[model samples]
Target chain A: MNLEILGYSFIQKGLIAGTAIAIICSLMGMFLVLRRYSLFGDALSHMAFGGISLGLFTGIYPLWTAFIVSVLGALGITKLRKSTKISGDAAIAVLLVSGLGIGVLLISATGGFKVDLFSFLFGSILLISTEDMLLILGISSGIIATLVALRKQLLHLTFDEEQAQVSGINTDKLNYVFVVLASITVITSMRLVGILLISALIVLPNITAIMFGKGFKKTIALSVSMSVISVVSGIILSYYLDLAPSGTIVMISVAMLVGTLLFKYVNVLGKSHVIQKLTSEA
Target chain B: MNVLEVSDVSIKYNGHLAVDKINFNVKEGDLLGIVGPNGAGKTTLFKAIIGLQNHSGKIKLFGYDEADYQPLLPLIGYVSQKVSFEPNFPATVSEVVSMGLIPEKKLRKGAVLLKNCGYSWNLLYKKVGKDSDKVLECLKTAGLESLKDRRIGDLSGGELQRVFIAKALVKDPVLLILDEPVTGVDADAQNKFYTVLRKINTENKITIVWSSHDLEAISKLANRVACMNRKLFFHGEKEEFFSNKELLKTYAESAMQMHMHDHN
Candidate 1:
């Protein structure tokens, strides 16, 4: 193992930012995927790209603009799905394409900094600065704290929304909170995983951990551990192999999901064989 | 005083009237069974009482105005008819029960609401299933104490229904609203479930309002009955519900209509 990379400040910053992102993504993503809103995160990430380009064009802070645009975009998606005849996935796709189109138009209008914009699209995890690190830490802490406080309510809502509302929970208001949190999670983690791959960080760890059949809290714990492992290992491998960190991280996540599926299959096969053997022996 | 009062309540969905000007009152400790054919708006009435649907008429809960019942929402527990989820929601029996005790706030108010629901400040910060007396009592009352650690998806239909009942009971609710509480349970299990509910009514004095298609079982248990088919056809004591020729005729005709509609 090339352990000497820890000496580099950029590596340290990348690790910190990656860890923060991994925690938030896994936690928030569990609820999203379970609610069948995985594409909502994807759409928000694309919208954040538009926000980033708008900020760059207007000469302001991109993260702030991305945060605002992503939140509004999420609300718009929610409203469109609720009010319009368009399907939920269709609504998401519409926003996704519009966002990408706007982002491209802005980039072309600016006519320079194509390299800088591409970094946001594909990510530049190794180039994380102290300011970026601080933003990640602050946003991650806020998201985690809010989730912890609303843990039981969120569980109730996720498990059975109608029951939650019937039990006097203000589900409409809670929904807004979920949208805002998801938007924040997508936008803040974009730098670590890139616009294209952010949803993978939010979704894959949760998909894998749910296969373990652990209870909700245990699933969340396992997902966070899995996400952090994939992120850290991917960063280290990328550093050594001179690969794209975002691509490497997403690939590692996909690998972990496949591994869990295979293990589940083998475990089922092993159990059935044991049962058959016992029956034959008897 | 009546535990619940619904006056001239009507519900419209997409310009179609589902429940029309229905009126009823439930006395405290009454096991009120609402019986109706399919699409007869029984569930809609329950939703109206739980404040889940918009209605034109007034609903009074324990003397609180309809709009003012938000603060008292914790006092009413509702079990849904449709138990739909991912089937991998990662929740245990006790965890689902704990959600009932989570208080209602406009946003992110789970902890604050839990504290207001009589949980001590210290207990609010602790992990779920810290063996609180209220949770244990509700579980024991609902016969789910033995399955507190069981994942919700792994439970049998009867046991799963009890878990939901336990979740509702944990709040010490004044009214327990159940929509088709025994839809998928076996016949034997349904009888046992009714027995448990009867005991809960007698021992805990929790007012129960349940919707069901099983008229015989409901008439056997419920002291009051509300018969409906898009409107209130009858509302009175169970004896009157059984003896009223006009009411019986209406129910029979509605049942025939439903059977024909299904075939068509």
Candidate 2:
């Protein structure tokens, strides 16, 4: 309610970055969720933790290392799933566990969970540096642009991968590109909700949107709106309540999901109940 | 005119030969039914033809060589076995069918895409109006015009098959390849599906090379039949395939083996 909060540059940056990442993650999440890789963001974010730890241990920029490790890790998961011998679910679990395992080991090596580790683990969106803001803006735009460009191909591939390939799509390349983009989205989203809960930002709104039983594009539209609303409101509330921005954002997302589910089932139950009563009267 | 030519095609799958040294040619407008029991490599052969699986062979489409099936893709429409995607994929019938046009529009008419929308995804969404009539025509052919706006998941297996068939037809492809499309469909849906398949073959004159478990359906529709159990059993006139008692026995044996495997 305080208009004075808008005057703080850090608050403005956090809100902008949060909204941007939400849009990117929600859009990316829609495609992944449809493809049945709903936890891919979660897996990649865990790898990003390991990636950041490696960066910190090696004295490299943590975000750059996070990007590198996450991309490679995502590609590995994709390759594993494609091999047929290894199931996609197993591949996801492997990467998810490996990332967290390595991250923990490296954290211990770095002499426990310091302020740096905690900052990335839970995020510091409210204190986003200008460079981080620029990075978020750049990454968000690039991701959105690429997704829109490949929309049809992605749609066809998502709907039916074999059919997409037979359509002369270099599906292999497209898939790799897709995973890379997903990795970028996961890594970029880390600043918003950190490694621990970035997947919530990526997947929650999309899941909620699906509960509406809308078409794919409509689902995406609904998801984006829900995500933006959650991010914007979560940020404002976080400022006023003196809570963590990331937790507030994800909490709002969880609230939206529960609310949508309630509305959906109640409407369904009400309709079916009416039908049952009418039949009994007849 | 040979619509499809496969020479010395062989596939090594899971450390064994799934399809071995297969050779066949499908002439223009020919309805060729590929029949085999489960694991007979009928699906494998289809996958090879459609470039889904790796194989060592020579494949020519429209007289063009293999490894460059890129140019020939727009001329071919492929529907794989069982589809088996998440039932909740969220694509409506029309949106999926409209996607069939993307390969054609991207491959054959690049300039139209450039002019319409710089970003091809926007172009697809924007060009939906332009392709609506065409999408409907394909749907009509598949008897799915009624389900145009329905979410594909809401449809039954038969209806879903028809949706994919409709999606394939949106390209107005010269070659239509379907793998076990009517399997798991009920008798009534099967009949309706056959009716659409017959219309496309006889009226539209689309060259179809399909793999199916239904030999009876193949006998009724396909002019040519290829019976296989890894290696080609017979590739000739449908009458020859049916009338040969010895060959029929071998085919029956493979079918029997499939049943055994299923039970196991």
Candidate 3:
């Protein structure tokens, strides 16, 4: 591909926006994986659709509306997890379905909407604007700053809530904060990957990182790197192949996960002899 | 003075009473053992004392009722029954130990708190940073110094239990509460763990309360025993409770059966 094709202002904005979303989602994905709340990402992404529809109905900025709605969904999930006997997965399912249902109703009520909902469903790189790129950057920076400030508390809480509480961490508050951050990341990433595929950006890279990374910090770094590679590659492939960016990105992430798994398997097989010898000695 | 006093405390879960009308007092240097069946209220009682569960009646820690003595939490160290840490959580054994020091906020500089807990400086340095000396001492005390750099998720069941103990001990708590501290450990590790507990209790004069299903082990280690099965079935000296055949039959029938089966 020529530099002009890649360097077009619109394409450049799309790439920047995609990169920012990739970083935020990957970093936040680590926490979601650790806390075993990966599905919460999916739930909030769907819930953001409702917020987007509501924003359209109210003539408000959909991004801000989506952010607020996602936060509300996050808070709802947190509250439901604590106050009810429902499992996290069950709660997520309920919230996801209800939000999607509300979103469909609201979108139907809007007559001759300018933006096609299908574009947001599978994502449209062509829709990237300067404003959207700036929003992505802002959300990315916010996630990084919040994670840094609460790194210690988050680490402790993720490991053991009872211990964290005993150690003077306000676990209840931190839980809300973590989920809220996750909601915001979902909203931001939805612009690039769409509601249907956003969670892949949040889950796939983190899972791949977990298989190979040594520790928490390394896992996060590796996840971000993998996300960046996948998103950038996916965008290029989408452009050349005339495919949806969302589908391409998710497929690439899945491929990377499979590659990482195979690599781990081969490494484990190579180390089996040493492990067997050690076990026999023991 | 009694460091902890509980009166008519009851805890319910989803309409089922896990602990009903339990009462006890813990004094300085006291080793109180709580024993019961799987569904018994032993663990629930510990949770209630730590303010992890809402319950009826009153719990006084350091002479203040639990409701009003939120500040007293810093003086108490708790080790839960289940060690369900995030498997991929990024924390070394030393960092896990330092979690116990959180309540203290600002630990005294160059203090031997970690040393007393059993971690050394070298192991601490390998885990987080130079400031992890206290954490290393805690690991050493818990007999996990060599594994200081190891992530918490990689630890064995027995090793993880000890890590929690080390975390608790690093606080130099006035009272230490452990829930089923040796549920999955081998017999040998269990004995060693009890020895460590006894040593800590004797040497530091720290009051200790631990729950276990092993009546024989409880008899050996605990100076006082509290039998809880949704309520206080019995609470007194270990020998006295053991010698009371009727009370032992009612309080620890399963443990007694296991004891007889072992002898046979």
Q: Output the lDDT of residue A171, model 2.
A: 89
Write the candidate numbers in order of decreasing TM-score: 1, 2, 3
Considering only chain B, report the TM-score of model 3: 0.83
TM-score of chain A of each: 0.95, 0.96, 0.90
**Could you estimate the TM-score for every candidate?**
0.92, 0.91, 0.86
**Candidate 3 lDDT tens digits, B1-264:** 577899988889868988888889987678999887667777777777877788899998656655556755755778888877667676678777876665234333212433443333222222444446767766776778998878777877888888888888776676889899888789888887887788777765678999988888888888999887677778889888899999877765766665676678
Task: Give the residue spans of candidate 2 off by over 4 A.
Answer: A2-4, A80-84, B68-70, B103-129
On TM-score, who's better, 1 or 3?
Answer: 1
CA displacement after TM-score superposition, residue A215 of candidate 3 (Å): 2.2
CA lDDT, every model vs. true structure:
0.84, 0.85, 0.79
Residue-by-residue lDDT tens digits, candidate 1, A1-282? 859999899999999999999999999999999898888888998899889989998988888888888888888877777677778688889878878787888888988567778888888889888998998899899999999998878888988888788666678889889999999998888888789999899899999998898778898999999999999999999989989999999999999999999999999999999999999999
DockQ of prediction 3: 0.41
Per-residue lDDT value at B189 in model 3: 83
TM-score of candidate 3 to 2 decimals = 0.86
Better model by lDDT: candidate 2 vs candidate 3: 2
Every model's DockQ: 0.56, 0.56, 0.41
